[model samples]
Target chain A: MTARNLLLGLLAVLIAAPAVIGAYPLAVLILVLHYAYLGIAWNVMMGFAGLLSLGHALYVGLGAYVAAALYASFGLPALLGAIPAAIVATLAGLGIGALGFRFRVNGVYFALLTIAFAEFTRILFDHMGWTGGSSGFFLPVEHGQLNPIALRGPPVLFYYVALVMTAGAFVLARSLMRSRLGYAWLAIREDPDSAAASGVDVFRARMAAVAVSSALTSLGGVFYAFYYNNMYPEQIFSMARSIEIILAPIIGGLGTLFGPVLGSFVLTLLGEGTTGLLEHFGWAAPGAKQVIYGLALLVIVMVQPAGLWPWLAKRLRIGRDG
Target chain B: MTVYLDIVASGVLTGLVYGLMALGLSVIFGVVRVVNFAHGELTVAAMYMAWVMAGSLGVDPILTLPLIAAALFAIGYALQRHLVEPFIGRPEHEQFMLLLAVSIIVLNGLLLVFGPDARHVAVDYAYDSFELGPMLLDTVRVYAAAAAMVLALGLYLFFRFTDLGTAIRACADNLLGAQVVGLDVRRLYALTFGLGCALVGASGTLMVLMRDATPILAVQLTLLAFIVVIIGGLGSMAGALVGGVLIGVSEALAGFLLMPSLKSLFSYGLLILVLLLRPEGLMGRRA
Candidate 1:
C-alpha cells in the first residue's frame, strides 16, 4: 500500500481507538500522541537542520507556563492562550537560535546552549512568586463536565485533542520536509559550509527550523498543561522531560516522516508495559522507566543508528516514499 | 568588606573542587574529543562511593578519595574502551545520545540503588571553623579545597612531566599523527578518560564534605561542571580551574546578593556571554 493509504488507515484506527481501549490504555495513548507530536516538532531541528538541541523542554515549559498562567490568572481560554504560547516560545527559540547560529556554536556546544537556557528558565520559574514559585502552578479542575474551550474536563476530550495535534504535526513536518526551505535545510544538514558556498542561506534555514520547531512544541506544552491541570517547574523543565521528547524521533528514525510516531508508540507502550510489570512485582521505582529509555537509546544508536522505522520499513517493504 | 571576602574565600574553596570536577571533563574532551555527557552522573556515583565507604567502614570521607578515584578510573577506562570508542568520529548527536543514555542509566541506577534520600557524610570536623583574620572558614571547606588544590597540582605536574601524560597530550594534539608514530591512541584515549573520571571522582568525594549527596544533584552538577569547563575553555585544564573558581565565586555572590535559588543565573549568564564573545574561553587556545 501507498504511504498515504497507510497513514489514512492509521488515522481511522486512532479515531476509533478510545472506543476499543479502556480508560488507562486511552490515557497511555494520549501520552503516546503527546510524545509523537513533540518528536515531530523536535525533528524539524535535529532531523532536518542537523542542530542537536538537548533541551526542547525549554520551549515546552515556556508554552505550558504561558498558557496555564494566562488561563489561571485572566480566565483566558486555553484556545486563545495557544497563540501567545506559540509566540513566546517562538521568540525564545529565535533568540537562542540566533545567538548560537550567529556565534557559530555548532554540534555539542549548540546543544549545551539549549540546556543552559532550559535550566536557566527552570530556575527562573522556580523563583517566580506569581506562578506559585517552586510550590507549583495549579489549574482549577472542572469535575464531570466537558469544556474543550477552556481545556477542562474528561480524558476523552484531551485524547482527541492530542490525536489532532499528532496528526497535524506529522502532516506539517512532511510538508515542511518537502518545501523549498526544507530542501535548503537538507543541504545545510549535509554540509553547512558547502550549503553556504552554494548560496543556501544556512543560518536563516537553521534559524527557521528552530523557530518552527519551538513554536510547534509550545503548542504541545499548552495541551500538557491544561490536560494535567497543573505545572511543576522541576518536573516539566527537567532534562529528563527534554530527553523524553527526543527519544521517539531518535529511536524511531531521525529524518523519516513516520519515525517519530512509530518511536512514540513503541516507547510509551514499552514504558507503560514495564511500569505495569514492575508494579505487579512490587519493583516499581521512580527511575526504572528512564533507565529503560536510556538502554533503548544505547542499543538503538549502537545496533541500528538509522533507527527502527527506516529499518522496519525497508524490511517490510511498506513504503518506498517514506 | 569582610563578608564579601568571606564569600570569596568560601567560593574559591568550593570552586577548587568544581575545578577538579571540570578538569576531568576537560582532559577527556581534550584527548578523546568525546564529551562525557555522563560526567555529572559519574561524579554522583563517586559521591555515593564515598558515602558508602564512610557509612560502612567508618572511615573519613577524605580517606576514601583515592579509592573512589581508582574505582572511577577503572569505570571510565571500561566505558571508553567499550561504549565510547566506537562513537569517536560519529555525528555529534549520536555521540550525545550515547553518552546521554549512559548518563540516564547511571543517574537512574543511583536512584534505584540508593532511593531518593539525600546522603550526607558526617566528619568530626563538619562543624569546626578556622579563623583566617576576621573571616571564619569552615574546616571542611578548607580541607576539601586543599585536597583539590594538591590533586590539581599533581595532575598539572603529571601532564607536564610524565611519559603517559605526554603520550596522552600527543594523542590529543594529532590523533592521526599519534597513530602513525606507533602510539597506542586507543589506549591513550582510554587512559585519558580514566584520568578525567578520577579527577571528577576525587572532586565528588570532596563535594560530600560540604553538602549533601543526592541523585537529584546529578543533572545540576553536570551542568555546573559543563559551565566551568566552557567558561574556562573546553579542552584547557587550567581554564577549568579558573572557570570553576569564577563560577563558584559568582554563584556565592549571586546567592548572597540575590536569592540563593538564583545563583545559577549568573553562571548561565557568564556561559552565554562567553559563548558569544569568546567561545574558545579565556584560557583556551583558539579551536
Candidate 2:
C-alpha cells in the first residue's frame, strides 16, 4: 500500500471499528471516548503545560452534580444545564490554577493541592442534603432516552455524542499545541523563569490551560451524568476516577496526540476483560483481578515508561508519521 | 467536667499514634520527592504479619515488634528497589503515576492474597484496658502511644545526627548536587524508602493491637496519612507531630460537640482549613 492510502485506510479502520464490533463493543467504545475526552483535557495541563492535577475529579463530580441538580430541581433540559455547569467547573479550575500559580506551586505540591480542593468538594457534597448527599442524585435516563430531552437517547446516539466530543477535544488540543499560546505554555512548562524573562505571559497561558482543560472535563462529566443516570461521591470524585483520567494519558504516552485515546482503550479493555473473567468464574476468581490490575500498572509504569500507545504504534508501524 | 477531661486524654493518646504514622510519611517525603501511596498497605501488611507471628507462634504482640520491624524493612527494601526506584528520577507526574499504579496493585494484591475478611490479632491487648476515674482507656492504645513516642523520638535522633540520615536529607534537598559529591544516591533512596515502610509497619502493628485490619484500610489510612502529612508539612519532622495531635484533638472535639455522624466531616474540613491557612504546614518550608 502507498503511504497516503495506508494513512487513509488506517483512519477508515478506526472509524469503522466500533460500528462493526456490535453493541457490546460499542458500549466499550463509548467508555473509551468518554475517558479519552477527559484524558485529552487532563493532558492539556499535565502533558502540555506541565501542571499535575491529581484531583481532576473535582470538576467531573461537581459538573455532574450541578447538571443533575439543575435537571432534578429546576426541570431544565441537561443541554441547557450542561453549559452553565461546565462554566462553573471552568471557573473552579481557573480559581485553583490562579491560587497555585500565584504561589509558584508547581510539581507534586500542585498535584496535592488539586487533590485537596477535590477532596474538600467531595466532603461538601457528601454532607450536603440539597444534591442528595451521599445517597446520590440521579438523572432520569428514561426521559432522555426517548430523544425529546436531547440526552436520554439510545446507546447508539450517546456513543455518537461521546465520539464527537472526544474528536472535538482532540482537534482542540492539536490546534492549541500549534498556537502561540500553546508555545507560551510549553515554554512556561520547560522553564518558568526563562519563559517569563522571554516575555511570555506565564500566568495567562497557564490560566488558559486550566480553564480549557476544566471546561472540557466538565463536558465529559455531563456525558457521565447522563449516560449512567446516577452519580455519587465515591463514584464520581474518588481518587480512582482521578487515576482513570491520568492513566489514559500516562499509558498512552504523555504529550502525544492519540496517547490518551489508545491508553483509554487498552486500560478500559483490561478492566472490562478482567471483570468479565472474574464474573465468569466467581468462586475461582474472587478478587484476583484487582491484584492483576495493580501489577499491570506497576509493570507498565516501570518497564514501558513511554506508555502503551507509543509502544504499540511502533510495533504496528501505524499512526506515527514521525 | 470529668467527661471533657476524659475526651481530651483519649484524644492525646490517639494523637500519639497519628504522630507515629505521620513521622514515617514525613521522613519519606523529606528524602524522596514522591509520596508513598502504598505506605498504608505496608501498614496493613505489617498488621497481618503481626497477626501471623503472634497467632501462629503464640508470641505476644508486644514481643513481635522486632520481627515486624525486620520483616517490614525487607519488604520496604524490595518495594523500593523493584517497585518504586525505577521511576524515581522521572518528572513529578511520572513518579505519581507510577506510585499510584503500585498502590492499586498492592491493595488488590492483598485482597487476592488475604481475601476480604477483616482479621484481628486477638491478643491480650485487645481485651486489656485501664480505668482511671470515670474514664476507660484501652491498654493497647496507651501502650501503642508510649511505644510510638519512644520510637519516633529515636527516629528524630536518627535524622538529626546519623550519617545515613544526613545523606538522605541531603539527597532530598539537592539530588544532583549529592550525586556529584559521590553519594550512592540509589542506595540512599532504597534505605530511605525502607525506613519509611518500616515506620509504617510500626504504625500498623500498633493499629492492629488497638483495632482490626483489612486490605481496604490501606487506602483509607493512606488518605488520612496524606492529610496528616500535608497538615504536618511535608518533610518536616516536627510538623508531623503537631499536625497529628491537632487533627486528633480536633476530631475528638468534633466527635464530642457535634453529632457523632460528623466526625469525618471535621477531619477533612480541618484538612482543607490547614491547606488554606498554611500550605507549608506548621513547620514545612514555604513551597
Candidate 3:
C-alpha cells in the first residue's frame, strides 16, 4: 500500500461520498472542509512554528469580503476575485508576521497581538461603507441547482469542492512538514535561540510560514463567501470564527497534517449529532452548543492531552507514545 | 468644558471598575501563567450572586461586598485548586484549550441557570444623581467608582505590604524560585486566584451600579478586560489601572468624536497600534 495510492483512494471516496449524502448532509461536510482547510493553513504558523494566533479570522474575513465586493461591484468572475482576495489576505498576514517576529513577540503575547489585529480589522470593516459596513454584503446567488465543476453550485458540488481543497491543503502541508523548511520550523518550534544559533533564519521562516498559512486560509474564506453567496464582518471577523479554525487542528493533533481533518470530522459530527438529538427532544438553549463543545475539549484534554490524532495513531500501531 | 469634565470623571470611575477586573486577570496570570479565559465568567457570576444576596437580604449590593467577595473567593480557590491546578505544568497550548473549555461551560451554565434575560440589580439609590458644579453623576456610579478606587488602592497596598501578598508576588515572579524558597507555591497559586476572584466580585458590584447585569456580559466584559490587560501590560497591576483609564477615555472620546457605532473599534485599533509599536504593552516589562 503506497502512500500515494492511499491518498488517491481516499480522494476518490470523498468525491463520491458527497453525491450519495445529498444536499443537507453535504452542506455540513462543506462547512467541515472549510474549517479543515483553515486548520491546515493556521497549523503552518501556530502548530509548526509554535506561534499562537487568536486572530486568524482577520484573514478569512478579508478574503471573503474582498472577493464579494470585487465581484458584486464590478461583476468580476470569482476565479479572478478569489485569487486577489487571497493575495491581499496573505499580504496582511505577512505584514503582521513581520511586525511580531521583528519584535520577538512569540507565544501568548503573539496570540493576543493577532487578536488585536483581527479586532482592528473588524472595526475598520464596520466603518467602511463600501464593504457594505455593518449591514453586510451579499453575493449573487445562483438559484437553480446546477452541477458545479469545482464544487461551486449544488451542496454536493460544494462538498466535493471543499473535499478537494481540504485534501490538497493537507497534502501540501504534509509534504512541507517533511522538507528542509519544515525542519527549520521544527527547530524554531523547539527553541528559537538554538534554532538561530544552528543557522536557521527563525524570523524569516516564521514570517514565510505565516504568509503562506494566512494566504491559504484567505483562499478558503474566498470560497466560503462564494459558496454561501454572502459576506458579513460580524460573522467572519469574529473571535469565535478564529476559535473555530484553531479548534479543529488542536483537537485532531496540533502539528499533524491529518489533525485538522480528523478534528473537523469529530467536532462537526459530534456537534451536529448532539444538536440533532437535542432538537428532536426539544432540549435547545442559546449557548448549549458551546457548552457541549467546551466539555468535549475538557474531556479530550484530561484523558488524552496529546490530541485525537496521536491517540488514534497509537491505537492503530502507526506510532508509539513519546 | 463641563461636558468634557463630566466625561472624563465618568470615564475614570468606569476605568476603576475595569482596572479591578484586569487586576484579577493579571494576578491569575502572574501566579499560574494560565490566561484563565473563565475569569470574566466568574466575575459575571459574582455580579449575579451580589444581586441575589441583595434581593434576599434586603441589603444594598454595595453593602453586601464582604459576603459576596468571601463566597466568590472560595469559589475561585476551588476552581483553581481543582480545574486549573491540575494543568499547571501541562504544555502551554493544552492549558489554553482547557481554560477555554472551562470558560465555555461556565458561560453556558450561567445561561442555563439564569436564562438569556438581562438581570437587573434593584437598588433604592441606583438612579439618584449627585451634582458637583455643572456636572451631574449617578449616585450609584459615583459610589461604585469611589468604592472601586478604595478597593484597588487597598489591594495595591495589600500586595505591597502583607506577607501572603509578598509570597504570592514571589510565586508570580518566579514559580520555581518560590518553591525553592520554601513558599507553598500551590497555596500561593490558589491564593492568587482567590484574590483575583474577590476583586472581580467587587468589580461586578460596581459594574451593576453603572450598567445592567446580563449573561452575555461574560463574553463582552472579558473582551474588554483582555483589551485592558494587553494595553496595560500582562502581569502588571499598575499597567491594568493605567490601561483601564486609557480604554475608558478612548471609548468615550471615540464615540463622541468619531462614528457613534465605532467606539469599541477605536479602542481595539489602539490595541493594534500599541502592539505594532510596543508588544510588551504600555507599561509591561519586556521579557
Candidate 4:
C-alpha cells in the first residue's frame, strides 16, 4: 500500500517536475525516460523469455525509418505513422524469431543471427537514397507555436510524452508479468526441455515475447524520430545503440518490473554526470562515457549478477511486487 | 576478361590474409569453446602495435610480426586466465557479455588513443605491383598472402605434430575426459587462446600492409571475421581458409559488378544463407 502511494506521489512529482527544473535537467529526464521505456520493452524478450538479442537496434531503426519516411514523404504525422512503424518492426522480429527457433539456433548463435540481420539491414539502408541514405533523414522543425498533434513542441512536451511512455510501459510490463504468457516464458527460460514437457507452447510463447518486445520498442523509436527530428542509419541501428538498449535491463535486474526504469535512470545520470565532470575538469575525451559503460557492465556482471535494483530493493525492504 | 581475372586474383590474395584472421577465431573456438567477440579489436590492437613499432624502429611492418605475435599471445593468455576462465562453463550470455564488454573497451580505448585517424606504415613497396600474365597484384598483398599461408601452415603443423598441440586437441575433444586424464585444462585453455591471438596478430601485421589501421575498422573487421568463420564452418581451420577465399572473391566481384558498398551486402547475405541452409558451415561437423 505504501509503495503504491509512493509511486503515485512520485508520478505526481514527475508530472510537476518540468515546472521547477531547468531545460537541461528536463532534457536529461526525458532521455532517462526514453531509455527506461526501451529497457522495459527489451526486458520482455531477454529478461523474461531468455532470448538474448544483440541487435534490437534493428527494430529501433525499422520503426524510426518507417515513421520518418511516412512523415517525410506523405506528411502524415508520427502519431498515426507509429502503427505501421510498429507493425514493420514486429514483422521483422517475427521473421528472425521464426527462422531462429525453427532452426533451433540456440544460445550464442541466435544472438549472432540477430546481429547478422541488423548489420545486413543497416548496410541496405545505408545505400537507400529515398530515406536519405547515409546522409540522414530529417523532419521539418516548427519553432513558433505549439503543435501537439504533430508532436512538434518544446522539451517539456517531450518530457510528458516520455513520462507517459515510461509509466504505460511499466504498467504493461507489470500486467504481462502476472499473465499466463509470462509464466510460460519463465518456464521456457529456466529449462526449455522441461517447459516443453510441461505442455508449454515454447515456440509460440517465445515468439509472443519477441513480438510484444519489438512492437513496444518500435514505439520508442517513433518517439525518438519525432523528438530528435532526425534519423541516421549508422547511429540509429549501430551495435552501440543495441548495447545501450540492453544495458539498462541487464544492470537494473532482469525480469523485474522496476529494474529497467531504475537501470535507465542510473545509466543516463551516470553517463551524463561523467560527461559533465569531464567538461568541468577540462578533460577533452571522446569515448570516456562508453568506457564507463563497459566498466560498469563488467563490474555489475562480475560483482552482483542480479543487478542494482534487486540489491537496492533488498536493502530498502521493498516488496517483491516489483 | 583480364580485369575480372585481376580482381579474382587480388581477392584470393586478400582472402588468404582474411583466412589467417578467421583461423585464429576458429582455433580459439575449437579449443576453448568461447567465442572472442573482441577478436577484431585485438586484431586492430595488433595492427596498431605493428604500425607504432614500424614507425619507431624505422623497420618494415613485416619485421614486427613475431614481436607483436608474442605480445598478443601474452595478453590473450592473461585475459583468458583472469577474465574468461570464470565464465568457461557458465551460461553463454555471461560469456558473451564479458567479451562484448571487452570489445567495447578495446574499441573505445583505441578511439581515445588513436583519435579515429587512419594510420598506415609507409612501406617502401607501398605502390609496387607484380604481374602474373594478365593479372596485376599488389606486391604487399602478395607478400601478406604468402606470409599468411606460411603462418597457417605453421599452425597446422603445430596442431598435428606437437605434444602440447595433442594435449590441447584432447582437451577440446572432451573436457571431462581431459580432466580425468589429469591434464591442466586451465593452462591449456590459456595456451590455446594465446596461440589464437598470435595467429590473429600475425594477420593484423599483414593486414596493415593492405589497409590503414583505424579504430573504426574494428567492428567491420570483427563482422568480416565472423562472416568468414561462419561460412567456413566453426571449429574447422581449413574451412576458415575456404570461407575466407569465397568471401574475398565475392567481395571483389561485388565491388566490380555491383558497388563497393554492396560488397558487405553480399557477404552478409551469404552469412544469412549459410545460417539457414547449413548452420554447421561448409566444413564444420554437425554437433
Which candidate achieves the best DockQ against the true structure? 1
Clashes of each: 0, 3, 1, 0
Candidate 4 CAPRI grade: medium
DockQ of each: 0.69, 0.52, 0.62, 0.64
- lDDT, candidate 2, B21-123, per-residue tens: 8778777777766677777777888888888887799886667887798778888788778867867767666677677877877777777777878887776
Candidate 2: regions farther than 4 A off: A1-19, A141-145, A283-290, A312-322, B51-60, B114-136, B157-185, B233-236, B259-261, B276-287
RMSD of 1: 1.5
lDDT of 3 by residue, B92-128 (tens): 7778878778877888778877788888887888768
Give per-residue CA lDDT, model 2, range A42-62, as digits (tens).
999988888888889999997
- Top candidate by lDDT: 1
Docking class of 2: medium
C-alpha RMSD values across all candidates:
1.5, 3.3, 2.7, 1.7
Stretches off by above 4 angstroms in model 3 are A1-9, A145-152, A319-322, B50-59, B111-119, B173-177, B233-239, B280-287
TM-score of 2: 0.89
Candidate 4's C-alpha runs over 4 A off are A1-6, B280-287
- What is the per-residue lDDT of model 1 for residues B23-56, given as tens digits with 9 covering 90 to 100? 9988888788887899999999999999999999
lDDT of 2: 0.78
Q: Is candidate 3 or candidate 4 better by lDDT?
A: 4
The worst-scoring run of ten residues by lDDT in candidate 2 chain B lies at: B278-287
